[model samples]
Target: MKAKNDAPLRSRQLIGYFVFSILLNGFGNGLTVAMNLGSALWTASAVNLAHALHLTLLTVLLAEGVAVVLFNALVLRRLEWRRIAGNFIFMIPFSFLVSWFAQLIGMTPLVALPLMWRVVLDLFGIVCTGVAVSIYQRLNVMLHPNDDLMQILRFHFLHGNAALAQPLSFVPPITLILICVLATRQAYALNIGTLFSLVAQGAIVGLADRVVFPQLKHRHLVV
Candidate 1:
């Protein structure tokens, strides 16, 4: 029965997973941001930068994306245009979705909810992020530049240990966040949720890989 699925079907499944990731990732980020509990480290860095620099979230995100893409070239020790384009392509819809979801969800009354429920939402957001990341990272049809950087570090430097690569990959963004915090004299998103993401996102993705869309194997070639 499983063999009934063919190449085109698999292609569609990948596409479907890609779209689902974009939505889930966007919604998850929105929830985290609106909760003001915390966000994934990279995202928290972007959000803090945006607030400090008085720029839009999309602007900071794109700038960070480009920087990561270039840094990826440095890691690979060469340039790859297709991979760069794929990163940008994923950013477009993803950025818009995140902004929209944030605005929509932020306007709701959940902010007045109890601390317990807010914590639940924050954790759920983090899990959503981990799961979405698992989907696209496995699909490997394309990836967020930051995730690509993790892949580069994981396979190329860290001996394929995603657990180590995950936090290790945070060095750059974490540095940026530190600078932003000092310059701005405040931090917006660095709480339990961010801590969870920093430590456990890789594990969550690993878990999701064996569970969510279990049939989807990692297409771990170049792009």
Candidate 2:
């Protein structure tokens, strides 16, 4: 009789674990957008090209999400060579698509402005999202599917190298740059906005890591 009661309690505990993970991941994603909202809005207001930048960011995010889903279903499930290859391959086109859409959107009169400004905006967005994901993962909460896959791959290929963690940590931003370049043919240029955005995103990510995640950790510990 006690065993039967304990079984439900254990199941409930597992369910709670899943719920906490989803909530933490979702909150991290939401905070990332909030952190970058200023740059996005400023770009839209100050530059004619901001709208395209906005659309481009949205598209790339969507593409990344799709890639994550497809990889999980087709590759991760099978745990085959194709999964790793497909994941990396899809990322390249996804990057290109992001830049292409940003350019295409920038061409519209509504937000058509300088190409350089749009590039800065895109870079800022990428850096913020990457930082946010990293901090959120450190909370030891549920992970984004992509993050989980990367960790798994890291274990297999790198033999659990601790340094591999940081490399995987930086992969998102690197991929973002590749995507930005694929979409935009212009030479990379550094500007005030680019620097500021990177700093701002880093700051926000740091605060979230230092402040918010600790509280979350405590809550789980108490529970």
Work out the TM-score per prediction: 0.92, 0.39
The sequence of per-residue lDDT tens digits that candidate 1 reaches over residues 1-223 is 0221122336676678888897999999989988989898888999999999999998888888889989999989888788889998987778778778878888998867899999889889989988998788777767889888887787678765777888888898889899999998999888999899899988887788789988877664542
lDDT of each residue in 1-223, candidate 2, tens digit only: 0111111224565455445444433333332232332332112221222232545444545455455645555533555344445455444443344345445544554244365554444455544444444443443233444654544444445553433443443355445554554555432322443344444543444455456534332111110
The positional error of residue 25 in candidate 1, measured at the CA in angstroms, is 0.9
User: Best by lDDT, which number?
Assistant: 1
| C-alpha lDDT of all candidate models, in order | 0.84, 0.41
Least accurate 10 contiguous residues by lDDT in model 1: 1-10
Q: Per-residue error at 77 for model 1, in Å?
A: 0.7
- Which regions of candidate 2 deviate over 4 angstroms? 1-9, 37-60, 69-143, 169-173, 181-223
CA lDDT, candidate 1, residue 31: 91
